[model samples]
Target: MSIEYGEAQLLPGEKIAITTDTATEPFWKKAKERKLTACRCASCGHFRMPPTPYCPECQSREMSWPDLPGTATVFSFAICTRSPYSGEPLIYVPVVVDLDGAPGARLVSNLIGIKAEDVEIGMKVTVDWNPIQDDWLLPIFRPV
Candidate 1:
């Protein structure tokens, strides 16, 4: 039998912090405004996450940011039973998701609003934001 995990991994008073740079800042900026975007190759129209400066497809620095559908498919996941920080008992699901409207781009984020046992590969989910440090937002997902 599997142990029960709570709906949230971050305890009541905890917050998440993040750091962003030039290449990745656009995505984070959009996220802070409650919008979801993926980096696209302006020339070849390919999508990539963790946004890089040049397109791997056509060797171009031109890129575009387009809002996504805010939905995703659970490509893979893992169930955690302990907090990496506190070493206390906690349960949260870490997932790699295939983003809608962004072909070939996958994002690593957390899954919330569902029990651990119910999370399945290929499950449909939608984006939900959690506040993080410096007034930023995090994109967690819920069942769609």
Candidate 2:
């Protein structure tokens, strides 16, 4: 993938730092096992699909991993064709998906298995998981 920036860039498969959150650690651990886990606020009874320690709605610390709807809609997207570094263009579409059963909750991921030009802002999409390493399984998205 190419970055729109003209200066130096980072490439895929290159080492990078991923900030982890205590609330989301369980989600990641479950992702390592190829399961999509989300968080739900026990107090408010609202689900946070991406997982978080405190509920953004009520600021309650009573959170737990609950089964997600495993469905989403594309709230926004961008057609990306430039890689961070110079090489064969790895075209990808970046999108923010609003999770079902959790209004206003969204997560960002690459839109794969479809042409970038065909992406739309309000398109229907779904979650996808790909294991890149022994311990890292990334969550991606695709058209439904």
TM-scores of all models?
0.92, 0.76
In model 2, which range of ten residues has the least summed lDDT? 2-11
User: Please, what is the whole-model Cα lDDT of each candidate in the order they appear?
Assistant: 0.86, 0.68
Where is model 1 more than 4 Å wrong at Cα? 1-14
Which residue runs of candidate 2 sit more than 4 Å off their true CA positions? 1-17, 48-52, 85-88
Question: Per-residue lDDT for 17-45 in model 1, tens only?
Answer: 78898888889899988888999999999
Global local distance difference test of model 1: 0.86
Q: What does candidate 1 score in Cα RMSD to the true structure?
A: 1.8
In terms of TM-score, how similar is model 1 to the real structure?
0.92
**Pairs that clash in candidate 1:** none
Point to the candidate with the largest TM-score: 1
lDDT accuracy of residue 60 in candidate 2: 97
